[model samples]
Target: MNSSAFRPRLLAAAVSLCFAAPAIHAEEADVAQAGQALASISVTGARFDAEPSLAPVGAIIISADEIRRAGANDVNAAIRKVGGVYGRQSLDGSPDFGLDLRGFGTNSSQNLVIVLDGVRLSENELSNAVLSTIPIDTVERIEITRGGASVLYGGGATGGVINIVTRRPQANSRSASMFVEGGQFNAGEVRLSGAQAWDNFAADATLGTQRTDNYRDNNEFKQTHFSGGAQWFASQFDRVGFRYEGARQEMQFAGALKEAQFTAYPRQTLTPNDYGSLDSDRLTVFGQRRLYGHDIAADLSYRKKTVESTYFYDGVPSPATYDSKQWQFSPRVRKLGAIKGMVNELVAGVDLTKWERTTASGFSAADAEQKSKALYLRDELRFDPAHEGRISAGVRREIFDKDYADPLTFAAYDAKQALNAWELQASYMPVANVTVFGKLGQSFRVATSEEDSYTPLFNKPLAAQQSHDAELGLSYASATQKITARLFRHNLTNEIFFDPTANFGWGANTNLDPSRRQGFELDAEHRINAAWAVNAHYQHVQAKFRDGVNDGKEMVLVPKNTLSARVAWTGASQTADVGVQWTDKQRYGADFANDCAGQMPSYTTLDARYARTFGQWEWAVSGQNLADKNYFSQAFGCKAGIYPSNGRQLKLSARYSF
Candidate 1:
């Protein structure tokens, strides 16, 4: 089908399913109840437990069961199914996948914020988050809050925020699980997890290791992760906890391929000896108390990471090491009361963080540091007792102090910046099972250490990036069906990004001219029957430079359209699922001039899984790229800089409960 006809047909099918929901047999009322329960689940990523219908923005929650149904092996694999989001493999050959949201293209990682159990996983560098270090088995749920969220997350939230909530021990219970898996291309993994709860104390721990000789030559990868936590409950509303996590990873890079090279030898490496290793450790202490109708909580954490890599420069071997450390503390309080005879909720919080990194090479050493502090407050008012009408407003002020020094070059630079963010949101339920919501906000981002070090202007700091964001949406939820459609727009100034054409082709990180990104998204799901279910999502985005040298030019690597769908079946002791994803063509990475000879080609892939439970154990088989399609979704130049997507692969796994 043609692109124009494809969208309408898919959308009509989804609408049909939603409209047909009312005809379902009365016996399926239980299914509707279950759907309603899921919709009411609280979203912790918003700083407080708030339901999607009660919030002004769009939010999607992926439960652990849904993750398993998708047969995702990692966090990146799981979240790629979300609307308006895309994932690409790391160029460095590490397991850290880059995720793009709302057409941010090459700067996606710097625009999106990632949080793990309330701890910011997004770093102050131009690098992606190490999602592979998070064991899938330990995750309870994943919450995706779309649009600018700087008012609560501080910074780097122009695209949104993703929070991964882990499983916790339940009171008076003890449980354990073990998982082992083996797959194509000499891949293997093992994981062990246990949790215990007694009296007022609870504890949980997980250990996992994985090794794989991926589909390409010289692309071996290995990683080990360990995490544990303990909590003491003084009362039903008070608690203290401690958490520790550590990870070690090593990998070999299979350098990028040119057109001819990729066509002839897609799985061969150009740089055979390139390799890297990473080690990270983190510790956190947190506590919460409730008194006098007020809830207070605090979190303190420290983290350290070391990375070493060796790659050929000018056909000569060169090696470097990076050491980084960070400290963070956050405290917040929430209260419920009455305002103008209406129900009201107020939340206030403070954030403080310090980070520093040192890079050592054969020539000289360089150092960089960033310190930030922020304060924010938000208030929500409900006009009715049923919460059918509500409005909220929030504001945040943050300050950053940055410094960079290079001994060899004798270059030292320091900068200070202050940024502000505010948002006004409203939601109304005019009829049963229907909601209309709208929000307007402002967000900002600061230059990373790497970006600052390569500024085109000698010692002059780059301006901070800023954006004006707005969204309007409507949603309908019922026992057997759920549908949501939204329109969003972002107008940005001084967008922090790398431009290869800058400084006479020397390529430096710099601020770009005015740009805009606007899109429409549609998401729908229907329970066909007691054992069958189907869901699909479609997104259309227009991203371009609004003014300047590249006026009206399409942004590089930002696809205009994307779609995904899935069907699942469940029986007495067996479950099966199938899914497909499609992406439209777009300009190559760094091709901001829109002068590339050819755009990256559009592609589609299929995935499927089947599992059966037997007594206290379960077994499953899964396959990715089932059709063995050949395509490349990422490229950095007009014709070269290609990274091929993996071909057909299959895996078998088993899990046991103890």
Candidate 2:
């Protein structure tokens, strides 16, 4: 059967079930109680998460309470324990790290979609959306979708999507918090945040600064961030919000070492004079209104970012600068409630974004511009009472245009591409405590400027990548325990990737023939009692080249196995947690021939945290790599060996809240 007919048939079956709902009677009170328990631990960043058993797309949520309990210093630290997430650490011990998802390798800047408060943060092409710009002290919660989301989020969501939600003021309330921390490696941090609200207005702000003299030679870093937001309730049915953020940071780079050097002196830096800096600013305004019995929302945002870097390769001076600016607008409408005696929820939206970047190297200058527009519609239906079962379908059409030009050289290049994406999802609860779900979707990802035109002499735009995704999952939840298991696969064509083996020392963009990634994930949380709990997550994935010269060969840098486990205990005044993480060895790059000579070794780590709360004051202490195990967190080609992860380090912090 054609896939196009699958969606219509699914919709018809759901409607028929709804019309025959009277024949089936469920325990209403029991259903409501089960729903309450599900809601307490459900993922809600997506439109389907509003109801029970409707989110079948492998979603994970990390709350602020969890973050604080983990003694997380940044976003990367808080998300490391999540399944299917691999955070590669640097030698400096900075939390501004890179991540790999769904066996997508180590370069996630072009494969992941990151957002903050409904505003696109990594929509530009200059650099990764530095998560450091958003202070963790101000975050309320984070939502992560582990699979492709091109139908919900516009583009470059081939790997997944991460949405960060910030704290908002409570009605008729005011609060403040302050934190100070100091640790090994001469690290120091300070943060302050406050929120206030009146009858119909609320405002909040956060300020933070941190500096560290890293463990490696010539690796020192400093950063400062400011974020604020205000919201006004014009009436009971309308509200508006404005948010602003700015950040500045500077750091010295310690280039990678050779194999022998890394083994003999792990903390040595190959390039001690290299340095980099960043400055960024963003502003967003959004509004929501209840009109015509529907919910309407709109947002507008502007962002400007600049980065400069100087590196010495083989004792040769090389300096470069990048400046990028972007504007985005999104408007959406949602309809909820009964329609034709069936519970129906519908959503429609449009998104528009424009971005421009300029790069200067020595005396040569180049400019690139990109624009995207999309229209999308989604519908959800619930057949049984209390939304025991749900079916959701969505479709999106997107248009993109990109251009690059050099004024002095009179060189120009342009490309235009259009893509269509759709997904079908269904979830059913055979029993009050168990849910079974399935999803099928098509996803698209366009190439970025860096991936297409930023090479030494490349000016042609790469072909857009496409993926066919399918997933099946089972979830079980009780009042005190939860368990989830998922099986997923992604078939990709013309997958764009960085070719480090091309053009000598400079990397080039290339499209691979075809590839496939299939994986299984298991996650569980159990509360032994009121004072003891345990959580564990595991993922096993196999990534291989399906066609071309590398057919049947495993993809480099994509690990086959990963695991995370944690145990915690809480008392009246104190809480303690112990966690362990492990990763399996995989092929390392440098040679595209899939040679076993470049394989990276596997390693595991142990960590612990303890916190005490008394009255309005709190104290916490944390230790990472508690076993002092030596491991390689990241490794490049054969020429650039591996970077050693941090050794045993301890830190203490103090916080006050009122």
User: What are the per-residue Cα lDDT tens digits for candidate 1 across 1-658?
Assistant: 2222222222212111110001122233443442343344345734754445344356777889888887887888888853325776666554556787788987788899998877888878777887887878888888787789999897889888988888755679998899999999899999998899898999989899999888788888898999899999876448889999999888777766777787897888877887778888989998878766566888899989888877665579777788889899999887655544455567899999999988787753879899999999888766764547878899999999999999886768989999999999888878888888898999999988777876789767789999999999999988999898989999999998877677666567789999999998888889999999998878898999999999999998788998889898999998998999899998877578888788888999899999999998989999989998888766766666677778888999998988
Residue 485 error for model 2, in Å? 0.8
What would the per-residue lDDT of candidate 2 be over residues 430-509, giving only the tens digit for each residue? 98888788888999888776567534355667788999998899989899998989899999998887665555645566
Off by over 4 Å in 2: 1-57, 82-84, 90-93, 234-237, 314-316, 407-411, 454-457, 503-507, 639-641
Q: How well does each candidate superpose onto the true structure, as a TM-score?
A: 0.92, 0.90
Q: What's the lDDT for all of these models?
A: 0.79, 0.73
Worst 10 residues of 1 by lDDT: 14-23
Best candidate, TM-score: 1
Q: RMSD for all candidates, in order, please.
A: 9.4, 9.6
